[model samples]
Target: MVSELRIGILGAGGIAERAMVEPAHEVEGVRVVAIGARDPERARAFAERWDLPKHGDYETILSDPDIDLVYLALPPITHAEWGIRALEAGKHVLCEKPLSVNGTTASAIADAAAATGRRAFVGFHYRLHSFTRRLLDVIASGVLGDIERVDVDFSIPHFVVKPGNIRLDGDLGGGAVMDVGCYAVDLIRAAWGEPAVESATAVLSDDDPRIDLQTDAVLRLSSGAPVHVRGSFIGDDQGAMSLRIEGSEARLAATSVIVPQWGATLRVSAGDGLLLEEKAAEGDNSYARQLEHLVAVLADGSPSILDVRRGVGTMRVVDEIYRAAGLEPR
Candidate 1:
């Protein structure tokens, strides 16, 4: 059996409690060695529950000699600072999505990781799903002929209403575009192989002046294809999240694109009026699979799918979207 990777969690927030702490315990080649949080009581409680070593400050965990990896589940604004510190401390890091609040910070962390010779991975867990992998293959294979246009919708319910949640604040790197809209941008770039954003137009709501709670933009790609993206915090809980690509000879619609827990549905309509649909098998834990991939890559010294370079590009697009909307990135 492969040696279990020793992991230390930097934050015991909701994500750490629900996704990392629980599922990681179930993986064979993984072990939770330590946890750190701002609150001593809370961190200790989490460690007691998970049977791990707990610390009130992140540096305590970082200094531990037994930990092999560190997972940063902190706020987006703090991602770069903590990530850099962890890498300099000689710990491999798996940072949560968006990489950072903007492209500049993202690039800084990426450079730090490269300089340290330490493995760096992002928590773009959607890329780990088998269904999404197969969809990427189909798109790259050109089975549907030349691409024409792409329409994407990424939305979620109002899940966070608490005060100072960090997700709704603009200065702390919170917004509809920064949150749910990232998926739309990344998936489009992945399909197009490059983000040739010639121009963009966006509509913002007035309810939240601090952030773009509702944003819809039209982006032009290098291939001369027009892609429309709609991301919002005001959509219904039952709203759709998928990408529809119109090609020369066929059209591809990826149903259940955002929330793969509902299972993925792919539909292809050929020029001859024939249509085909298929559903992707579901897994209980995407987070587990993502960690598994990180461990495997670290073991073999292979590259990761969502490495720092890709994350920097995604953040750059996000910075552009914010600029087009007449809002300076926070």
Candidate 2:
């Protein structure tokens, strides 16, 4: 029997409650032993609810010699520091995305991972979704031929309404681009394969304390494929999130691809008629899939499907996009 991997979860917040603990409990050969939070009462409550051991400070979990892994569920601003510390402490780390706020901190985290020879993974959860997996397989198979263009649309109307939510504070690494917009950017990179950003432009809300709450940016890839991305946190309603890939032989429409409805079929049309249409199985929660992958990397030294190298590359592109848009790092 394979031994269960011991895991420590940082940040006993909603994201952890929804994305990590709840789903992870179903995966075999994984054990979440400890949960950490800044507030002792909050941490204890979360721990009791999840049936997990409690730690008031994050350092306690990282310094625990028996814990094999640490999950960083904190804000974007805290990712780099905790990631580096965890890696140096001989613990593998799985950090939630954007990896870090900007390229500088991301680079530092990547450097620490390299220097420590530790397994580090990022939580770009969308990539593990069934619809997206199929999309990647189709693109990589060259069934659509040489790619010409890609269009991505994203909008989230109901963001955090908490008065002191880190997502709204620029100093705390808050912004549409860093938070939600990065998903579109990441998808573009996954499709284009190592493309550099040519330029970016953004429009901010009137007297907005944070960076632009909406962004429409055009990216010119080195492969000559141009990507158009639209993202916003404030919208009339939640706009449709989709991706259209135009290639030499035909065009593939991934309508409502981002949050694909379960039991609904995804159609790939060839303009003349339907080419492929299939309903994806809503099996294996993405959080579970990512955790399994992280465990495989730690247990047998397997390569991470979404490792730090990719995380750093994604952050660099986002950093450049911010620079082009005249949004200075906070």
Candidate 3:
């Protein structure tokens, strides 16, 4: 039985395009029925472009009876409010990563979803990727022995190149931490359970002190394994999208953990002898995998992978990192 899942998008943006609109077309039994943006004209344009059947404002999607799932592709600051609303409206929610600007709001959304008995998921698509599972499997197999420390980073030149991008705007829940760092934080939490933010510091943009141009944070898991997470928008190289795990027995390194649809490479070594090396075939979209999970969760009553509780936990680390860095949380 192919049970259909109807999706209503609350934001007409690039992420909605990449993570939902585009993937919705490829995945079976998933339909993006409606799309809404603050700008009605933009929503209409996006609807037409994506071949969505309907378009309107956020309220319209929430009010629709047939829209069983609401995908909140809005900014971090807006996630909690609308996520709760969609949950209350009898719609499950798939919010873009970060969940919210701070842990408090994320917790509120988690509570609302719990109260409503509705599923709410955060969009950390990479967590659903095979690269992540393989990395974890390698470590769990004891090939890496006891984890000593982990290093994960995702950086780009968006700060220098993409002028006026929403991610660079502080008031709109913009910052390197809120934008890209959440993925790093989530990956760390996924690899090593919840962590305590030991210390954090960031290079704030001279123009916008509220926005971190580059963030370097250190966290300690309960197992005493240390994690170094670096997220940046201003960078010299193409990007540093990789993870390194140092253990008592060996070292595991992975590249392109973020979007393996682009490319994925892995290397395991110890004392200069490469134990293993491999590359994943390109073209598997993590977003499509995520959509399939969401659909299965709804249809078969399956457990969610990135549920609200995990989202709130990730945001707690993010907020703690902000406090440790001497900046306000979002």
Candidate 4:
């Protein structure tokens, strides 16, 4: 087992700069040793801006003997290839979400992790947040009775800001479902067990019919409960991210459930019309919690709460939804 994990970050994207790199410094027993990008000069600039010790092309960091872990913040399309490579090189990996473009690639990553005996983690940081933990606790306590239905809405105005962004590109594993619908689907799977896609439909972009701008899916959990999930890119400017759980005995609602690191409010209403609210305490950001968890898995042999296996399950649901909507998987 490893003691301290030396991390090398792949990709110099927005998430790499904002979430993973700085958060690595805050986690004890974790160090950011290098940053790599396809462009050497871009990597150098990112490293210099972050005050990191080393920067180079992707091969430079992957071949470095001292780097025990690699944080892959590249796009979804590149996750499988790089994740497999890192595991084969005897390094643990923390790959960004959606794990891959589809279930097949995700399964390959899982297989590689098993074959190499290396720990592979997916970046579903919201699963590690305090609010999500509390939400799970409340559900487990039966306060919500038998959860009958769930409704989730997570929409953002991505197309408004960057019209031709990669997120709008169908070829690069881009769309509302791949980009944001994964989170909605994950929340459902986490709250209610693995689900079967009953039916799905989507609104394709007017300019680019190949890409989905909005999607609505119905999923049936093993427990017979139904979940309704909606995601969109050309949504209201106000940004909608909320969840409601309806049960036989009570109903629970939460705001800002996605990015609860800023703040979140949970309300529990009983059959008698009484209401209660619980607010999450300020703590380490989600990325730090995620980093700490990865370190623990590397140092000891703790099982990841949101492992690649679970990611594969989620991707299967995503693929099915696209097919039902008469569109191909990204």
Candidate 5:
């Protein structure tokens, strides 16, 4: 067993700074050893700001034997290649989602991880939250008997900002589904266990015909439970994120299911009346919890809940959604 886990940041971007580097300090038995970027000066600035010991190009971090893990915050298109390289270098990888541009690449990453025996975790931090665990427990308890339907919608109006942002680039695997819609799709898969995409329709962006501004998909689980998911990058709605699960006996609804760091509420209703209501306490950081779990997995060879295999399953759904919508997979 390892005494400590040393993590190297492979990208000096916003997610690397806010989600990984900052939250890593709060996780025990892990340290951020170095940061790498295309520009060495930018990497140096990020490393200095985060109080890390070293900063250099990507090769430098990859060559360092002291780094046990690599946190990849690169674009979705680059995830599979860099992830495979990191695993080949005998280092575990925690990559930001969507794991790859398509299902094939995601599967390749999973295969590489298996071959290397290196742990690969996707950055679906919400799965590590206490409230999400409670939500799963409630679902498994059978209180909401026989879930029949699930509705998920996550929309944000911020797509209008930064005209040339990567999220708007079709070649770079940018779209509503690839960006925010992934979370909704992941939530559905988490609840329904990898449903098959029945159908999907998307509204393409006016500026870029290949990119979707909004997408809606219908899926069916093995048990025939139908799930309706909608994601939008540009919408009239006031930035909403919620999920509703309807069962034969009762209904469960949660608000802000995506980023519950601020706080979240779950309400359950039955035929008689409102059955239960719960709210997440303040100071709940999913990133910290996720990092700690990865450290545990690295040190003791424990199973990770959001392993690379799960990432491949999620990406398979994503690829099918694009095909169903009559669009090529990004």
Candidate 6:
């Protein structure tokens, strides 16, 4: 069990900077000391930008005894190989989602973790956000009554114009569903209960039928509540990362559900047909809270919501969605 966790980032991508290194200092006894990438110069530049103590090719950080945990921000195609390697090297892993290109490959990471007695966590940091807690609170209070359905929309234009962006390349494990739909699907499962996909369809890119530019899936909770999820990458007003829960007695809606750090609003309304409750999301970035959770998991035996096993469960659903859409899973 690690008391002080020294982290090495496995990629020099934007997420490693924004999601891992930037929020790391907020967690006690956790420091991002090193970074490694396929390109040594990119890794060195990233390390210098973040003022990290170590940087080099990917093997440099993996072989470092000082790196107790590795946060993998590499492209989805590389997660399984490196996650397994890190676990075998006696280092815990915190991998970015979708964990891997598909569910079957993702399960190997869990297998690796179990065999090595090293934990592997998936980075679904949004679950640690304050709005999530508030959403749960309202549910537990029964103010929303019996849930009737959940609707989620998460889309961004980040890669729409970048023809070479990984998200637009099928070989890089890219797709609208894999990149953003995972969040929508995971959010419902966490905030409510496990769900089973009912039907799904996709709008494939003109250049690549395997690459979904947009995906829409319908799911049902064990409790019989329906879920409508839409993930997009090319359109404005598709679904700007919002969630709504319509219950028998009331309705709850949240804006900016994905990155509440940029500011968010949660509103609940009932029979009166007016706003009954309103809450604002404000707090540390969920990434910091996630790091804290990782520390606790290492210090003791705390279970993690971000477990790779759970991530595999999510990927299975994603794979099902892809199959239902008549496309192949990465």
Write down the lDDT of every candidate, Cα atoms only: 0.79, 0.76, 0.87, 0.85, 0.86, 0.86
What value of lDDT does candidate 6 attain over all alpha carbons?
0.86
> Residue 40 lDDT in model 4?
97
- Model 1 stretches with alpha carbons more than 4 Å out: 158-164, 198-208, 271-275
Q: Where does candidate 4 stray beyond 4 Å?
A: 158-161
Clashing residue pairs in all predictions, respectively, total: 0, 0, 0, 0, 0, 0
lDDT of 2: 0.76
Candidate 2 accuracy as TM-score: 0.92
TM-score of each: 0.92, 0.92, 0.96, 0.96, 0.96, 0.95
- lDDT per residue for candidate 2 within 132-179, as digits (tens), equals 788778878877788789877776664433346666677778777887
Model 5 quality (TM-score): 0.96
- Candidate 6, residue 117: the lDDT equals 94
- Give the clashing pairs for model 1: none
Compared to the true structure, candidate 3 yields what TM-score? 0.96
Model 3 ranges off by over 4 Å:
158-161
Where does candidate 4 have its weakest 10-residue lDDT segment? 157-166
After the best TM-score superposition of candidate 5, give how far the Cα of residue 145 lies from its true spot, in angstroms: 1.7
- Give the alpha carbon lDDT tens digit for every residue of 120-172 in model 6: 99998877877677766776688888989888988786445367778888888
In candidate 6, which residue ranges exceed 4 Å CA deviation?
158-161, 237-239, 273-276, 281-283
